[model samples]
Target: MYYSRKRLMDDLPEEVTAIWSCTNEKCNGWMRDNFVLSARPTCVQCNSFMEKGEKLLPVLENANHKQSK
Candidate 1:
């Protein structure tokens, strides 16, 4: 008999917030959320890897309010 751990649908982590575009003026590329077992995530756009999305700081904060100074 084989027992496979069942994951409850509701138990899954919340949806990841996607970082839209790059913050660097030289290359404002788009990015996607990445997940790793240990820690750290990489920007799909610029490949500017980070441990967590939050660590990116103002770079990832460039969501809708792009024009703001």
Candidate 2:
């Protein structure tokens, strides 16, 4: 499974910030990256690994704006 660096970067969403957290309930860890350029980052906090197939939630922005004043 060889992928060109440029091609891989292009395939990922620009807004896909931070890698998904380890699903292990006992392990509370996450990988932070630009998403587009990030290959695979291990969770050092828990040593619980996360892979590409793992589910992930988008890091929402403008959360404060959504709140009603």
State each model's CA lDDT, in order. Answer: 0.42, 0.53
What 10-residue stretch in candidate 1 is worst by lDDT?
A: 51-60
The sequence of per-residue lDDT tens digits that candidate 2 reaches over residues 1-69 is 786898866565544444457667888766443342335556667756665443344444543443332
**Winning model by TM-score:** 2
What 10-residue stretch in candidate 2 is worst by lDDT?
60-69
Misplaced by over 4 Å in model 1 are 1-17, 34-69
Q: How accurate locally is residue 51 in candidate 2, as Cα lDDT from 0 to 100?
A: 55
RMSD per candidate (Å) reads 12.9, 12.4
Model 1: lDDT of residue 61: 36
Question: Model 1, range 1-69, lDDT digits (tens) per residue?
Answer: 674456444344554464444455666454343323223444555766443233232222325443322
Per-candidate TM equals 0.23, 0.34
* Candidate 2, residue 44: how far the Cα is off, in Å: 0.8
After TM-score superposition, the amount by which residue 59's alpha carbon in candidate 1 deviates from its true location, in angstroms, is: 23
